[model samples]
Target: MATSVNRSCLTYLLHLAQDNLDFRLPEIKALLALRGKSFHPSGDFQEKTPFWCLDGLAEEDVRGVMARSVCAKSAFELWGHGQTHSELRTSLLNYPSENMSPFMHKDSTYRINVYTFNKTLEFPDRIKRIDAMDYLPFEGTVSLKSPQHIFCLLEDYGTDPNDIPEHPNYIYFGRWIADGQRELIRSHSVKNRHFIGNTSMDAGLSFIMANHAKVNENDLVFDPFVGTGSLLVACSHFRAYVCGTDIDYNTIHGRGRSSRKNQKWRGPDENIRANLRQYGTEEMYIDVMISDASKPVWREAPLFDAIITDPPYGIRESTRRTGSHKDVTKHADGIYLESHVPVSQAYHLSDIFTDLLNFSAHHLVVGGRLVYWLPVYRPEYSEETVPLHPCLRILSNCEQTLSSHTSRRLITMEKIRKPEELDGLAQFADGRFSPYQGHNAFREKYFSGLNKRCIKEDNKAVVNGQ
Candidate 1:
């Protein structure tokens, strides 16, 4: 049995509120057990209210899940007395698990997440020397889980200005336990701090990674063409050595969106590199290197234990050109894809598959899985437009069953039974990049498991009470 000391919380980072808490939480408990741990639900929640409470759970039961012996940080003082607050300019975030079974549920678009911290929100504070108890209405459920430098600000009191905390604690929630106001926004409160932007990749896949707190520690994981370094960032946070690469310097992994094609300074030229610094990695610091994955150098036995990547668009289009940052600032949330290059200016989808399969054949180790995407447009458009690679097998289509935007068909492949038979799969190599989805690798981990275990495990399954 995996001892409690060996168990770390599995945090699920995905689109908040898309599925009910019931399906997501219980599955997390099961995933822990899969990692060889004795599991139990300490507490779980939505954006608002207590999903699980320590009051009902015995102290022993609470201790079962809150294994401090294996915690990353010794102690975190969140929700000490009143409300804690913080803000972020990125995609996802993390916090210890909490209880949330109250408040009425809302629509699919209104996403939220709930959390609990170590001995936090346990007892109300009574410090009066700073007139602490009644000062500034400071409180519990503070946003201490944030990776951002500023969280839980203490209101500027003593007019001296310098007397206050650098970014002091602001809001306060007493023993009353008021639910968080921004629960509906799935930033730091629920989603894992993987990618830089919100809702770019599949949230179901992102949720699984963000929610995952621990893994086979020290495992060597790879995310080829890591869009914005989302999968790799989450993997690093989940206790692994991460590697990611891309074709050019205009992506999340690449240099800032704006550089000089004509030697003119445009925007924050150091943004992407600076963003990576915050996560504690430098170029080549990780096991990754920039190169074309189409005809990659494959080792018979890969030094890497796992592989995850979001490849370039078979038809990629974006605004990540040499001077796109200035334009992005003028655009909304840096989302306008105004200028760019064609991913595959040469051929359509068929050539892409042949090359992609050949790349996987040589690079992906035996028993190592390759999870990728296959978009099937609405049923009516039937012209065999999307190319198919013979080696890659269709695994599942959970997204189609749940979402309305576009359904993704999950695909997977292992080494051919006989190595000599690697003839047909072409040598696809698309050089273009887009800022949209790099969920290729992680979604495989999420759905490939479902494809193997439960057939009905998806967003709709939660609503249908599976």
Candidate 2:
């Protein structure tokens, strides 16, 4: 009981990668939620910083989060921290001797690493920092190559590159636990992907999306607008059974023009399943079919464990669906020729989200998440613009900036209840609930900024005569 109490009170330090500043917290929180844990900061917390001190987690809980987190670089069992070396010494001396004795035994071999955020230290300086820790009782032999235990001395120089501090703003020392899955980003990069499209999701962002959805082993995942199946690839990597639908026949069959440079056409072997196979997750691939998002073909039941997708923003890929402005005439027998082709019409961004939310409400299991991107004209964006449904609740809204005037928000929502008869008509009854209809003009606003920039460049060129 005493050992368990000591373990429960232990604080853990997380060294998060500085990139994707907006996504690190949500990703970590979702991963912790998967382990049935809550995020409890030990002190004043700064979300943008590289170091985070957490409480209310066991060593196994930290390892479980590290196993799937891409935002975090490494986790440690915090021993002592302070703003100055003298204070750190006092803190370390005040720490329980029993908690520090196991790893510092004479028979053990260990190594210490010096990590400085937003700064670099010379070899002599790093060695001096290690020497400064001689005040602690460490009887273990130092092993530089391989060791049974690893510890780190982390210093924060602040986030600003313009201002470099002579002394660190904060300092922390801890025993290393485990490293996060950052290597997955490099290994699964779209640049090296077998099959890709014009708008394939980035490898890091793809994994972040999967983490945000809390995808787990054997979970059934679906993507409504699965272009070349980048999101599917991420989900399958997490051991989920993945499938998707797209309206483009060529893309669905991988017979279209190649997305690779200098390659005019895609090879027969290049397809969504082949991409999964390339990563040795072909068993997770269920199927990919040519279908429209506006007209889902799934049965009326909560089937999917999670829905993750990146819908077309009418920029790189035109938002379209199977439909026509003109009326179609049916034969007396109500049949059409097998060779007849259906026409497609513009799928406005507003209606696209409406259909997506409604579909998720009907198809996603209770507590299942729906993660997707929503393009925004930054100047006119507001919380009210986000689409809402009676059965679904919004969880997170993170932004990825594209240009000065344009950006995309990664919106995560969960199904809290089944849809009722009035749920489908709730948006119509309330104007605020349907403000996304104004987003139909997103494409126009997106291009208007570019046109203005071009005109300005032209005026400057005319003023400064060649």
Assess each prediction's global lDDT (C-alpha) against the native.
Answer: 0.36, 0.93
Quality of model 1 by C-alpha lDDT: 0.36
Q: Write the per-residue lDDT of candidate 2 for residues 1-466, one digit (tens) a residue.
A: 6766797779999999989888888899999999999999999999989999999999999999999999999999999999988878888899988888889999999999999998999999999999999988889899999999999999999999999899999999999999999999999999999999999999999999999999999999999999999999999999999999999888999997998999999998999999999999999999999899999698999999999999999998999998887997876798878666678999999889999999999999999999999999999999999988888899899999988998999999999999999886786897766646768888999899989988999999999993
What residue pairs are clashing in model 2? none
Model 1, range 1-466, lDDT digits (tens) per residue?
Answer: 3333222232211111223332334323423433455434223433322222222222232332333111111111222222233232111123212321111122111111222221122122312212332322223323335412221212212223345443323232211212211221243222343224321354344324333322234766666556555555545544566676554545543344333344333244333334345556534236445444443555654455445554543333321212222323344564556463424222223333445555555554554445444544333222233333343333222233333323454344444332345344232332221111232232344345446455545656887987
Task: Give me the displacement of residue 267 in model 2, in angstroms.
Answer: 0.6
Worst 10-residue lDDT window, candidate 1: 68-77
Flag regions of model 2 displaced more than 4 Å. Answer: 330-339, 461-466
